[model samples]
Target: MTKIGKALGVLAAAVVLPLTLSGTAYADIPFNQPINGNATYYDNSGFGACGTWVNAATEMLVAVPASYWTTPNPNNDPLCRGVSVQVSYNGRTITVPVKDKCPSCGSGHIDLSLPAFSQLADPRLGNIPLTWKFVRS
Candidate 1:
């Protein structure tokens, strides 16, 4: 092959190689399990007391109370601030995080922030009846 052709081929490989490597690296990370149960909220106390959820696209988002949101060593791990939750309603399952505290929520029910709730249920439904299981990731 001509020198110019070989040089171009090398340049293309240089750009493509790293992208290929990164894609594999990303794929190695396991996706979180689907939570299917109920949900409830509690005060964040730097003890991994936050919540996490999985969207329809399987993306996980976590939510912690504002108080614990800035505390160091919360849940003893830098990444443990978010709570993992699975919500089950009428045989359908949805998981989501508590991005913020629910000022209006009573005991045994975590109040999901508007955006988070919307992701799991229709906003027009008002409050959804669901069961959630919490876990630390």
Candidate 2:
């Protein structure tokens, strides 16, 4: 092969490699599958990532990991489109709506509102290992 052709091939690979790798990472989120991770509580008053106001004390809600979020507008996200999650820990389980994004959470982790967290464990526990899955309502 000519030197120019080899150089062009290498350049093309360099240009496409990062995008391909990122796409692979983006596709790693298991949207409908059970996810094992830790759960933490947060004060979810005021505006949320789903572009709606929330009350931590009254509403049972959760902030899912940002890694699973792909929408340009939070309001248009699939999680915001009537998605809920059933979280289980220490024989306790509670279902909560996905109403926000947890920027600090990893792929399987979630941030639950105060009320939601209390149903699973004492708020003083702060954080706990849990398993959760998406639920349809």
Candidate 3:
């Protein structure tokens, strides 16, 4: 093949390679896990289920599944209240503290404070797919 043809072939492979690959590139977190889910935000006032009132515009916090709060589980006894969680979308990742419970969020889903959501993506995106995992604070 001519030089130009070979270059075109390489370029084609580069473009198609990522499309064919399955799964996204994310941090290699421990526990062999990255929980994938949908993320949304709620603008509200007053205290959260966790009983903490925070400035949503500045605080970096998230609301986990309400089941963890409404239902009794030994595993979350001390969700630590302010445990650090890593939230990722697209290629950006932000670490935020777990500050409340999301009674509406399903398993694997998390509700981020507006500020936390803005850190990883534009609020204009509305809802987005993301991956998250707990990390040592």
Tens digits of per-residue lDDT for model 1, 1-137: 99999999999999998677555543432235433323332223331233333232223333433332333323332224344555566666556643344334443355554455556677567656665555444
Off by over 4 Å in 2: 1-32
- Which candidate gets the maximum lDDT versus the true structure? 2
Mark the 10 consecutive residues where model 1 has the least summed lDDT.
Answer: 41-50
* Per-model RMSD to reference: 12.9, 6.9, 17.7
Q: TM-scores of all models?
A: 0.38, 0.75, 0.66
Q: How well does candidate 3 match the true structure in TM-score terms?
A: 0.66
> How badly does each model clash, as a count of residue pairs?
14, 0, 0
lDDT against true structure, model 2: 0.83
lDDT of each: 0.46, 0.83, 0.69
By TM-score: ranked, best first: 2, 3, 1
Candidate 3 C-alpha lDDT tens digits along 11-84: 99999875443112112223225789878876665675555676655677887776544225323334533356
Model 3 lDDT, full chain set: 0.69
Clashing residue pairs found in predicted model 3: none
Model 1, stretches more than 4 Å misplaced? 1-82
lDDT at 30, model 2:
56
Candidate rank order under lDDT: 2, 3, 1
